[model samples]
Target: MPISSVEKDLDALTMTIVAEFPVPVRRLWDAYADPRQIEKFWGPPGWPATFARHDMAPGGRSSYYMTGPGGERAGAYWEFLAVEPERSFEVLDGFAGPDGTPDPAMPTTRMTCTFEETGAGARVTTTTSFDSLDDLQKLLEMGMQEGMTAAMGQMDAVVADLASFAAGRAAELQILSDAQVRVSRVIRGPLRSVWDAHHDPALLRRWMLGPDGWTMPVCEVATKVGDSYRFEWEQEGGGGRFGFTGELLESLPPHRAVTTERMVGVEGPGTVNELTLTPVEGGTLLTVVITYPDPQTRDQVLATGMVDGQEMSYARLEAEVLTPA
Candidate 1:
């Protein structure tokens, strides 16, 4: 077990757990920063987790759920209060309903996690403060301590598996639910560069083209919330023309963005795409969570080989836009 100690303070209504790992601090931090990696160890054995959204910046929120042995699910959410990148982060943690809404009846806790380097490797100290003594007692009775211990026990393996989550890999797709899917990739560029490539029309036109033998003729980009953008692509020698139009819903420079995307001439509801970028060990981790209108719509979009197209585009981005001459 990696856990060094677990201490509970009844007078202060707080509990602190300390764990050490034989890895560099950055490696340990990246495991938590990347949703794909963190989800592997967030839940105890026999209860795997799936994170639909994981924005690590302040004012952001992460929603996830754990599936039990018998197919039961327990949902939870975290509201990021502060993030000091690779050093520490604080969050308001609480239970949530299946829909990812916080359960007001359940007690919430403020948890602060600090990372530091040790002689051998690194250490993470997590301190969770309850609102009251009753709240602390209530959580302990619910196996909170045991669950945490079990969850951290799996982190050692995740942190050691560097090749799987390294940069230069193809984009990966994860189905969060019937209506939601998450696609992730690590770009060989900085966070700001990746974010800028998505916004700047010139930069986008250069790399956003999915496959060879195509040209992007129209590249209108949304600069702020509520602004609409359009993009159209045509095959070489004027074969077929297609495009997507969307309105920016939320924008947090260098970190996150949310938009509504649809086919230019389509009539039905569109998907809400949430994009998040985080600096990790290898490069910038880019995650896009798309919420479709329903399961059929989700399946239809994936059937078009969307992930493969995305991978090609990303590869182009690295070669044409991000790589230094």
Candidate 2:
């Protein structure tokens, strides 16, 4: 919704769109880098764009098609002329066929997108230069201005959704008593994948661990009622080693799982951890409620930065396992 104005320069044979987004320059740039994120808002309302392929780099090619209200499709391709990460990029845009072949009969434009950091957020400017004044007018008459405005507006929602998963942003850490702490993350993956990731040790080792350099060298899972499991991890240099063994109290595959967790090398009461995954648009919402035996026990865990550690683990899971397959 930070779109301010669309300007057309007849003498210069160009069109420019100016907008602001309350997110970091890197985050905004990622919207352009990820095709899945781009497809969410690459076209105007009711004309959703489907990207067949996207390679974001100099000399790279991206192919996509937009479906109109009446089911008609318009395909386009971008020949990336230059790329500069979170700074600026230039691309040659033109009409194309379903097979991603460029159409020589159609007009083309060279467009450059730039991003700048402001005190409040990031400012984005996009300028497209046509071959001639006549071509510029032709695109304007085709509602290019209004269509792009609407498409850019959808980016606000896209960035917001990304921010929701910004490591602990989706979770609320609450201390119910001297004995309970809860951590939740809204994962953007299907319920089944998330469920498997939690219940399958082989897949869990990929994302469920401490910060970089730490490894879950031991993971055993038996996700069944009355079954048991164990997890062991240590820092890269063999320092700060810790692990936990637990018994499964409840198991509802792809939905809910409960276990009694007892930690080693720590003097405190074991905790009851319940993990729940609920289906939601674009992914699943995961909530883990940990109940300690006493307020002293809860405070002890909090002092260990458990919340931040779990948040980091979930963030990794989101990037590696939660992405839509």
lDDT tens string, model 1, 1-325?
Answer: 8999999999999999999999999999998999999999999999999999899999888999999999999999999999999899999999999788999999999999999999999999999999999999999999999999999999999999999999979999999888999999999998899999999999998999888989999999999899999999999899699999999999888799999999989898999999999999778999999999999999999999999999999999999899998
Best by lDDT: 1
Q: State residue 154's C-alpha deviation in candidate 1, in Å.
A: 1.0
| Superposed Cα deviation of residue 44, candidate 1 (Å) | 1.2
Tens digit of lDDT per residue, candidate 2, span 90-167?
Answer: 999999975669988888999999999989889889999999988888888888889889999999888766654443
Model 1: worst 10 consecutive residues (lDDT sum): 204-213
The residue ranges of model 2 lying beyond 4 angstroms of the native Cα positions read: 163-325
C-alpha lDDT of candidate 2 relative to the true structure: 0.78
